[model samples]
Target: MSLPDMRFRAEQHLRRQLDFQHVRTHGRRHDCGAFMLWYARQAAPIAPVAAVPAASTDAVSPDGATPAETAPRSRSHQKKSASGPIPARVGVVASKSAVGNAVQRARAKRRLREAFRQHQLRVPAGYDLLLVARSSLNRLEYREIERRFADACLKIFPAAKA
Candidate 1:
C-alpha cells in the first residue's frame, strides 16, 4: 500500500542530466557511508506583478499643457511584487563500478529512493539532492540505511522542521 507521504511526486524527482550535473558541481556533499549525498538549495520562482500605469497624466486641459507635467511628483508607483519554490527533488545513482552488478545497483538505488521518499518532508523546500550508492549499500540492513539517512538529514539541515 502506498502512503501519501511516501508518494514520490514528479516535481520532486530530479531528472535530466543537466540537473544531476548541477547538483554535483555546486552542491555540498555528505558521506553517509553506504552512499554519498549531494544537495543544493535552488532559488524560489518569483511571479512578476504588473505595474499600474501612473494615474493617466492629468488629461490635457484646454491649454494642452498637462497639469501632471507641471505639478511636482507627489507619488511613485508601488514596486512590482508577487512570490514554487520547486519542491525538493532527489535523484539516485548506482553505477556498476560503485554498486556492483546490475541487480545490486538497482537494489541499491531502489532502497535509496524509498528511504528518501519516506522522509522527504524533513528536507526543506527548494533543494536538489543526489544520492550515489556505494557497494556497501547492498550489505546494509534497511533499518540501518534509514537511520543513516535520517542522521544525514540532521547534519545537512540542522534547522529542519519536524
Candidate 2:
C-alpha cells in the first residue's frame, strides 16, 4: 500500500521537522523512564515535548471537583492519538498473537490511523510521536486504544510552557 504523504504543508506543520524513526529507535525495548533519560542525552531531543497533563486524566478538575462531585467526565484521555509538529507521525507496534493474521494487523493499523486523524487537535505541533500498540488491542475497543495512545504521548511529551 502507498504510504500517506506526511509532509509539512506550512512552515508550522511539524511534519517538516519530526523524526518518527528517531522516536521509535529511542523507545525500542525501553520504558518511559529510560526513554526520558535517552531523550535528555540525545543530541536531537524530540522537539516541542509536552508532558501529559494531569487534567487529561480522571483526576481533580481545574475547579477541584472529584469524579463523584461532577458529571461523568468525557473520555478525553482515550481520545488522544497522534503526535508531531508538522506532518505528525504515529508509530505502531501490534502484538503477534492478537492480530495474528495479516488482515487483522492491517485492520488494527487502519483503526489506529483513523484514531490519529480524529484527534489531531489534542496533539501539539513540531513533535515526533511513537505509538506502541499493546497485544490486547485485538480485544480492546477503539476508544481505549485512542486513550492509551494519548496518555503515552503525554508521558513522552509533557505539556510544559513552550
Candidate 3:
C-alpha cells in the first residue's frame, strides 16, 4: 500500500516540557505489551505575544475602528472551534534507563514514532498523548510494535474508530 501524504509536523508533537509534565500529571494511562500510553484532554497552549501598547484615541481609523478591532482573531482559537475533529498529538519517551544504551533508545523511539505517524489519523483530537517505551519494545518486530501501538490507541479512544 502507498503511504499517505500526511507529514508529522513539529506542531503535531509535544515539544514543551510543561506539556509532557501536564500529561503525566493529569492524563489517564493505558498499557500495551511493550508500551504505556498516557493521554489527557486539554486545550493547546496559546503562544505568548508581546504586549502591544494601547492605541491612543487619536490613532483611531477613519472607520471608527482601532487597529486591534480590525485585527484578525487568532487562528488557534478558530481551530479549537472548527467543525471536524482535531488531530491527536504525541510525545515518545525512551529513556536510557528504560531502554539501555543510546542506540537502543534511539531505535525504540524511532519505532514508536513511525507507528504513531502511521496511525495518528486514527486517533481523536484534543488529546495530549505520551508513549513510554518498555525494554521489551526493542526486541519486538516493527509489525508487533505497530499492533501494540494501535491497540493502545483504540483502548484509549474507543469512539474514534470510523
Best by TM-score: 3
lDDT digits (tens) for residues 80-102 of candidate 2: 33553243445454455645677
Tell me the spans in candidate 3 whose CA falls farther than 4 Å from its real position.
1-4, 47-86
lDDT (C-alpha) at residue 60 in model 2: 82
Q: Report how far off residue 4 is in candidate 1 (Å).
A: 6.7
Q: What lDDT is obtained when candidate 3 is compared to the true structure?
A: 0.80
Considering only N, C-alpha and C atoms within 3 Å, which residue pairs clash in candidate 3? none
Q: Estimate each model's TM-score.
A: 0.71, 0.44, 0.74
- How far does residue 7 in candidate 3 sit from its true spot (Å)? 2.2
Q: Residue 53 CA error for candidate 1 (Å)?
A: 26
Q: Model 1, 53-75: lDDT tens per residue? A: 45566566567767555554422
Clashes of 3: 0
Model 3 Cα RMSD, 1 decimal: 6.7
